[model samples]
Target: MKRNSRLSLALHALSHMAFNTDQPHTSADIAAHAGTNPVVVRRVLGKLREAGLLTSERGHSGGWRLARAPRDITLADVYLALEESLVASPSETEQDMCSVEHALAIRVSTIMNDVEASLIERLSRTTIADVRHAAQ
Candidate 1:
C-alpha cells in the first residue's frame, strides 16, 4: 500500500534528529533536506509536537527537537500522530446501496481495518533510533 508523504517527511525529520540530539532543528533546515517548504514542515511537525514526540522553541537559536529519546519513539507513534491512513476505507455513502454492494462494503471495510491494524503492529516494533541506525 502507498502511504502518505507526511509520514515520510516526519520519519525523515525524526531520523535526522536522532543523529543530532544535541540541538534543535529548524523547519527551514528540515524542509530543505526533505525538499519541501518550511510551512509544510511546520504543519507536519506541529502534529508530532502535539503528540508529544517532539518539542519546539522560539528565538534565534530555537527550532525543533525530540521530546523523548529516539529509542522511546516508535514508527507507529509517528504514523498515528500524522493521522493519515495508508489503506483506503470503504465509503460511508455506500449505505444507500443494494444488499450485495452493502455486504461487500462491510467485508471490505473489515479487511481494510485489519490491514491498518497489521501495519501499525509492524510499525510499533521499530523505533526512531532503529531507523537512524539502519541508515548508517
Candidate 2:
C-alpha cells in the first residue's frame, strides 16, 4: 500500500512559495525539487488553489503564488485542501458476520474518527511560514 503523498507535496510547495525569488515558482521547478513529475506537482497544487490557499496564472511568465501570507495558511489548511482520509478502515467482513465483528468494527470506526479530528487540530497549530522559517 503506497502512501498518498499529496499532503506532503502541498506543504513542500507552500514552503517553497514562502521564499519566492525572482518569480513565482513554476510547476516544473517544484517537481524537480520534489523529484517527481510536473503533472504530479500540478495535481497537488491544483487542490491548494481550489482551497484558496494559492493562486495560479497562465502565460509566458505565469506560475503559482500564495493567495495569502504563509502565516495565514495552516498545515490543516493544506490537509483539508487535499481532502484525504488520514485513517483507513477495512470494509465489513461478510454480511453474515457475527455481532461481535460488527460491534468491533463500529468501535474502531469511532476511534478512527476521533484520531482524524485530533490530527487536524494538531496541524492547525502550525503554518507554512512556520515550517519555512524553521528550515531557514
Candidate 3:
C-alpha cells in the first residue's frame, strides 16, 4: 500500500536523532536532509512533540531532540503519533440508495481495520533503534 511521506520523514528524522542523541536537530536541517520545506517538517515534528516522542526548544541554539531513548520508541509509536492510516478505507459518508455498495463498503472497512491492526502489531515489534542499526 502507498503511504504518505510524513511517516518516512518522521522515521528519517528519528533515525538521525538516534545517532546524534547529544545534539538537537532543527526543522530546517531535517527538511534539508529530506528535501522538503521546513514548515512541513515542523508540522510533522510538531505532532511528534505532542505525542511525547520528541522535545523542542526555542532560540538560536535550540532545536528538537528525542524525549525518550531510541530503543524505547517503536515504529508503531511514530505511526500512531502521525495519526494517518496507511490503509485506504471506505468513506464514512455512504450513498444510502445502493444496498450492495453499502454492504461492500462495510465489509471493506472491516477488512481495512483488520489490516491496520496487523500493521500496528508488526510495527510495534521494531524500535527506532532497530531501524538505525539496520541502516548501518
Candidate 4:
C-alpha cells in the first residue's frame, strides 16, 4: 500500500533536533540533511510542534528545538503527529459492486484496522532516543 511520507519525514527532522541539543536547527539546515525543501521541513515539523513534541522560534538565530527529551518522544507520537496511517485500505469507489465485493471490503477493512492497531502498538514501544542509539 502507498503510505504518506510525512511520518518518515517528521522522524528525520526530529532526529536532527535530537542529535543537536546544543543548538536549534533551521528548516534550511534540516531540509539539506533530509534532502527536501525547507517548506516541507517546516510543515512537517510544524505538526510536531503542534503535538507539543517540538518548539519553533522566529527571527535571527531562531530555528527548531525539541520541547522535551528524545527519550520522551515515541515513534507513535511522531506518526500520530503527522496524522497519517501506516496501513491504508483502498478508498471507497463509486462504481457499483457485487455483494461479494462488499463483503470482501468489510473483511479487508477489519484486517486493515487490526494491522494499524498492531503497528501503532509496536511504534509506541520505541522512542526517538532508541532510534538515535540504533543509528549510532
Candidate 5:
C-alpha cells in the first residue's frame, strides 16, 4: 500500500521538534533537514498548529515548537490533523464488476478497511517520545 509522504514528513518534523524542545525550528530549517520545500514544511506545520499539536510565533526570532510534550502527541493526532486517508479510491473499471468481481470488491473493501484500521492502530501506538527515545 502507498502511504502519504506528508505523514512521514510530519512525523519527522515532529520528532525533530520533540528532540529539540528547547529550540523553536524555522520552516526553512525544517525544510532543509527534511529535504523538502519550505512551503511544504510551513503547510504541514500550519495543520499541526491548527490541531493544537504545535505552536508558532512571528518575527525575527519566531519559529515552530511543540505545543505539548512529545509523549502526549500520538501519530494518529498528526495523521488526523493532516486529514490523510489511507485507503485509495478504486478505479471506475474496478467499481464496475461482474458477480465474481463484485463479491471480490466487497471482500477487498472489507480487508482494506481492516488493514487500514490495523495500520492506524499501530501508528497510534507510538509517540514522538518513543521515536526520540529509540534513537538514543
Candidate 6:
C-alpha cells in the first residue's frame, strides 16, 4: 500500500507541537510548515483532538497544543486517530471460484496481513518525541 500523505502531515503537526510545548500553534502556522492547506490541518487536528492526542482553543488566543508529552504520543496513535486503513488490498470481486485465482487471492491476503502487521509494529515503536528529536 502507498504511504498516506495525510498521515505524514498529521505526524508533522504533532511533532511540531511537542517540540514547541511552551506555545500553541495555529492551523495556519502548521499548514505553512507542512506546505498544505489550513483547512486540511484543521480537520486533521480535529481528529487528533478527538483521539485525546491534542487540544484546541478558540478566539484570539486560539490554537492547538499537545494534550500530552511528546513521549506519550506514538505514530500509531496518530494513525489510529486518523482512522486510516494501514493496508489496502484488492478484493476478489471477479469470479475466481474453483480456479487458480482462488489460491492467488488467499496468498495475497496472507501477504498483505503480514505487511500490515510489520508496518503497525514499526510505527508503534516510534513516538512523536522520536520525530521531534530527529528533525532537530
* Cα lDDT of model 4 by residue, 1-136, tens digit: 2223788778888877788787889999988887888999899899989999999889899999999999999998988888878687968773666788888888999999999999888999999899888888
Candidate 4 TM-score, C-alpha based: 0.91
Which candidate has the highest lDDT of all? 1
lDDT of each: 0.94, 0.87, 0.92, 0.86, 0.87, 0.86
Error of 2 at 117 (Å): 0.4
Error at 53, model 4, angstroms:
0.7
Candidate 3 per-residue lDDT over residues 1-136, each given as its tens digit: 3233899999989999999999899989998888889999999999999999999999999999999999999999999999998888876577553888888888888999999999999999999999999989
Q: Write the per-residue lDDT of candidate 6 for residues 41-81, one digit (tens) a residue.
A: 99988999999999999878889999989999989888888
In terms of lDDT, which candidate is stronger, 3 or 4? Answer: 3
Q: List the residue pairs that clash in candidate 2.
A: none
- Please provide, for model 2 over 73-105, each residue's C-alpha lDDT reduced to its tens digit, 9 standing for 90 to 100: 999999898988878875877586688888888
Best by TM-score: 1
Task: Name the 10 consecutive residues with the lowest summed lDDT in model 6.
Answer: 90-99
Against the hidden reference, what TM-scores do the models get? 0.95, 0.91, 0.93, 0.91, 0.86, 0.87
Worst lDDT window (10 residues) for model 2?
1-10
Error of 6 at 27 (Å): 0.5
Per-residue error for 82 in candidate 4, Å, reads 0.5
Off by over 4 Å in 2: 1-4, 93-96
Between prediction 1 and prediction 3, the one with superior lDDT is: 1
Residue 42, model 2: lDDT of 92
lDDT, residue 77, model 1:
100
